[model samples]
Target: MGRGPETAQLSKYFYEGNDISDLPVNLSVVWNGNFIIDNPQNIQAHLYKCSALRESCGLCLKADPRFECGWCVSEKRCSLRQHCPSHESSWMHTSSGNSRCADPKIIKVG
Candidate 1:
């Protein structure tokens, strides 16, 4: 039997050389047998999402565009009163307040 139009299109994009080895065997049936390849950005995003540091600190060392933490340069944990050159602020101070540093439940990413 011949492939349907949609299937043919998908095959053209993902299996141009008739190589199915790149496709995941478990997910071959997810999108009507379409092979889903993760682009560079998608793979990076997934990595960031699964990262322990990213989850704990809400900061992706590889993906976040903004400066979320100031521990990149410091050799030790800084107190709220200490100045951080990377953050340009006191280590324990966030934009909101000093409670972020005081929170006992906060997980250390490093």
Candidate 2:
């Protein structure tokens, strides 16, 4: 589902047991099952954000010390090296315990 301000507002009402309709356009299409957001697979995919969950360089690098996490220097976000859309020059990973992100970059990938 699109995580805009509307989704935030709708989620609040949804989780509170309020009957909801006309979900956010993106969410509405897939939310044809139950009153609550009950699709297990979709919910898991939505909640399990891996790299994106790590908001900053420190948190991103802290995920697995370069094993599963890498920082995208140009984008300024935690991402997986293999899956990162940015250039290879922008990827930073752990080089020994010196694990750091391009000077300040952390070594966490998705």
TM-score of each candidate?
0.19, 0.38
lDDT by residue for model 1 over 49-97, one digit each (tens)? 1122332222322323333333222423422223444544434324444
lDDT score, candidate 1, position 30: 38
Runs with alpha carbons beyond 4 Å of true place in candidate 1: 1-30, 37-42, 47-93, 103-110
- What are the root-mean-square deviations of the candidates from the true structure over C-alphas? 15.5, 13.3
Any residue pairs clashing in model 1, and if so which? none
Residue-level lDDT of model 2, residues 4-104, one tens digit each, is: 24333234332222232113322333332434554544532121233544767666666644245666777777666766666477766664344464445
lDDT values, one for every candidate: 0.32, 0.51
TM-score between candidate 2 and the true structure:
0.38
